[model samples]
Target: MPFVIILVVLTVPAAIFFCWYQMLVRKYKNSSFIMVYHKVDRYRGGLKGLCVSPEAFDRQMDYLYRRGYRAIPLGSLVDSIINKKDILPKTFVLTFDDGYENNYVNVLPVLKKYGWTATVFLNAGAIGQTVQYPMQPPEKHLTAEQIKEMSGRFDFEPHGITHRALTGLSDDEIREEAEGSKKVVEQLTGKDADIFCYPFGEYNGRVINLLKEAGYRASCTTLPGIVRQDADAYQLPRFEFKETKVWSPRYFFRNFDFYLRTFFAI
Candidate 1:
């Protein structure tokens, strides 16, 4: 009985560990990780998880740089997948949601420091608007001028005009939101607004069709996972980089391990 009990304890943990290791391997191998960030600020209010401090952002970028991860634009990733090219090792795409002024102020410098660029999804109605979400005060979001200034380092895309959930709107309304925002972004940036990010990550078949009609080549969702070659272009998943545990090396690894284990079940 004693021998049997010891064997069971050892075997159980060993089996679990082996399974977890396999999951990690599967999760990272031949996959491109897309990380989504919202506000890069020192603000303590609102959804704290959505706000990553500039210092933390710098450290995270430094970590990626030290680890030899290559930051690629989302458009390049889409083209590669469409062309059936193998995703390079340690390739990652950085995305920022919400056209917050802080993103230009805090996030841009860090990215520029590393000579990297990211995709920013802009809420068409919020741009140049004084107020921001969670009832923040004016000048919260990026202005048209600010966006143009940062065009060299950021690829701006539409995040819906009013940031409404596309799934809840009627077909015509969805088309207006999707197509209108795309046009607005293109007008402001003088570049094709080829990508869309579903506001609140809420989408459906009709919404997807609307985005396609609007000339969007791809869209991003809040769904958590590494982007595989076979993944849907409109429903691409992203890893939300929360500020809570991302700063701690131990906690970050622990959370990452948990994410891999949870998403890639054996």
Candidate 2:
């Protein structure tokens, strides 16, 4: 039995090769891939450090251009996942959470250069509200007017009323967080927000249902994974792009196993 187990382990590589050969004999199959981004800025004070830098962001977009990755809007992504439509190999969606002013100042130009459109999730309460908690700083929040102007160029969605964590809140609180932002955005932009991005990517079944009740077509989680046909649209997963772009190669070329852990069973 010990020798048999050892032989099985030795034969595993051959088994994988056989399977690879069979796949070559059969038609190759590819799945849809989606990538998510948060902020794009220099590594410094506050939460801006977590976002991708201007140079790195440019490089990433350039790489995609050279590689033939076509950009898609968040709405199209929701439709594709919900309808189980085939996404091209060179297709992806660019999204940003928190609606930081840098998105307008820095990231917008880069995206414009590539003719790419990204989805920005705004916290209605924080739209023009100043941050008085940790530090006193003034950052523009893509004002209602700016949001409207940017409409034809990008998709503006809802994050929450105040970017509060919903995982520890009650059902009503969760509903308020989800529904309130949707209403605020709809009123501000005169366009209904169909997508919701969970603040800090924290949510559970209650939060999910509350988002649905709030009329959100889909919501994104910070969990890293690929969008598959069998995956849940409400808890869709995403990978955070860093300021350094050190892992862009591996991240952009993620495989099925990575998606399995990041998207499903979350």
In lDDT terms, which candidate is top? 1
Please state the error at residue 113 of candidate 1 in Å.
Answer: 1.0
TM-score of each: 0.83, 0.79
- Per-residue CA lDDT of candidate 1, range 1-266, in tens? 99999999999999999987887777666668788998888965766778788998898788777767768889988887777777777778999998899998998888889899899999998888766565544447899899999988899999999888989999999989988999999999988998999999999888898888879889999987777777788888888888776658765663573345334431
Q: Write the per-residue lDDT of candidate 2 for residues 1-266, one digit (tens) a residue.
A: 99999999989989998886666423222344456665566655565536577788888778777766667787887887788886545466788877777787787788788888888989788786544324324455666666776776688889998778998998988888888888888888788797999887888888888888889889888887666655688988776665554446765454444433233312
**Candidate 1 worst ten-residue window by lDDT:** 257-266
**Which runs of model 2 end up more than 4 angstroms from their true locations?**
1-30, 47-49, 132-138, 244-266
The lDDT of model 2 is: 0.72
Model 1 residue 24 CA deviation (Å) reads 5.1
